[model samples]
Target chain A: MKVAVIQFPGSNCDQDALYSLREDIGVAAEYVWHDSTSLVGFNAVFVPGGFTYGDYLRCGAMAATAPVMDEVRRFAREGRPVVGVCNGFQILCESHILPGALMQNVNQKFLGQDCYLKAINRTSPWTERVEGVVRIPIAHMEGRYVADAETLARLEGDGLVAFRYVSPTGELSEEWNPNGATNAIAGIVNDKGNVLGMMPHPERATRKLLGCDDGLAIMSAFRLLPVN
Target chain B: MVTVRVFVNLKPSLLDSAGRTVTGALHKLQFDEVADARIGKTITLQMEKFDEERVKAMCAKLLANPVIEDYSYEVLN
Candidate 1:
């Protein structure tokens, strides 16, 4: 099955995603421009991270309305894996494919550093094989996640949460909550479990030579699913 | 001609991080009278006629994120 790496005007992580999916996961992948309106032969889609539309109106707001998002929406509806990372996560939320919104960091500073994550929704295809804490780097000015009380409750109750920031030993604390995301969430899946949105850069950590490969399991999960 | 102005801001329950930072700077400047600060944005749209329904749709669809933000608009002709 081919993986379609969706690329927006300002997307910078498209190459990395393509490389990881090809070299690391051993899959067929190619770039799909934002103006494109189809994902015909692709079984999985990846919305890479970057400052799409120069972050106009709001981060991910403009890109969310792009033509390619329509195709991504189609894929999500059919239960195909659609992974959105970092800025891609913002775009998916803006497109209403995912719940909640990402806001400015509580500290009001751009963060570029390694973050630890723990799988919260272990039964989904996105997190089923993920075990223990995973180290991934995050680079964003607006990464804090916000949702209403009822939504948060529903996500938690429904087991839609994918990952949460935590300490090395899997402990939650203020120090590890880099952006003050509610429940220290780092990632979450849609109700159908086909759309996954997260604030960390998993593509950057696919090789152990790059310092950490904990993200490989997460990023490679798309191939593990049968495209159902 | 009609001019529509949209104001968007985080909900009151959510923390305005940038506004808090600005408030800290103001306190450092000895502006103790400023009890608090909240930051928001204003977007203006130009249209041939004031269409309240269209403006509402725009606000709901793009200008503001209903999840964490609230929006208000005014029309001037």
Candidate 2:
């Protein structure tokens, strides 16, 4: 399977994602510049992390309106897998393809550490077959997930929540939440379950040398899924 | 020429950590009268035409995220 990893200005993790997907996960992946307007050949799209547009006007705000996003939105509408990590998550939220907004961390600090994430939804293409808790590193200043009460209720009722911050023992608790995300949400999928937005850097954890390879399961799930 | 000034802020239901931090500093400086603080951004745009509706659309579409923030604009010529 082929994947497209979008590269916006100030995106630092594009290579990491490409390496993880292409080299480690054994899928054909290429970098798609943000200015490009098409995503025709790729079956899957990955939005990697970084301070897109220098995090100006709000993180991922400007990058969300890039020319290529229109095509990304269309690609998502086709029911293909689209995963956004870190600032990519912010961009997805800014693009309104995903629900809610990421706010400044409740602690008002940038957190760069490994955290445990519970797989809340095992049916989505990104999380299917992934078992139990996974450890991933998150590096961001604004990763707090929030939405209005009604939207939050709908997300919960629909089982759209893809992941949640949890203790190592797999218990959900505010203390284990690094960013104070609502409901300890670490990631979520759209109503259709094709689009996923999460703050953690799964690509960075795809290799044993990186201290963990649990993230590889996520990428593998996307690679293994049949093209739509 | 027309200029539009837009103000965008997080909704009251959301916690404003930056604003709270600023309020804490203010209280420490003996500004105890400050009971609550909210932080927001003001974006100034220069335009050739002044249309209230267009400006509102601009704010709604790109200048502010409707999910967590509210926005207002003033047109000046």
Q: What's the TM-score of candidate 1 when only chain A is evaluated?
A: 0.98
For every model in order, the TM-score on chain A comes to 0.98, 0.98
Fnat: each model in turn:
1.00, 0.94
TM-scores for candidates 1 onward, in order: 0.98, 0.98
Off by over 4 Å in 1: none
Write model 2 residue lDDT over A109-193, tens digit each, in one string.
9999999998888888788866888999999999999999999999999999999999998998999999999999999999888
Q: How accurate is candidate 1 locally (lDDT)?
A: 0.91
RMSD for each of the candidates: 1.0, 1.0
lDDT string for model 2 (B5-70, tens) is 899998888899999999999999999999988989999999999888888888888899999899
Clashing pairs in 1: none
- C-alpha lDDT values of all predictions: 0.91, 0.91
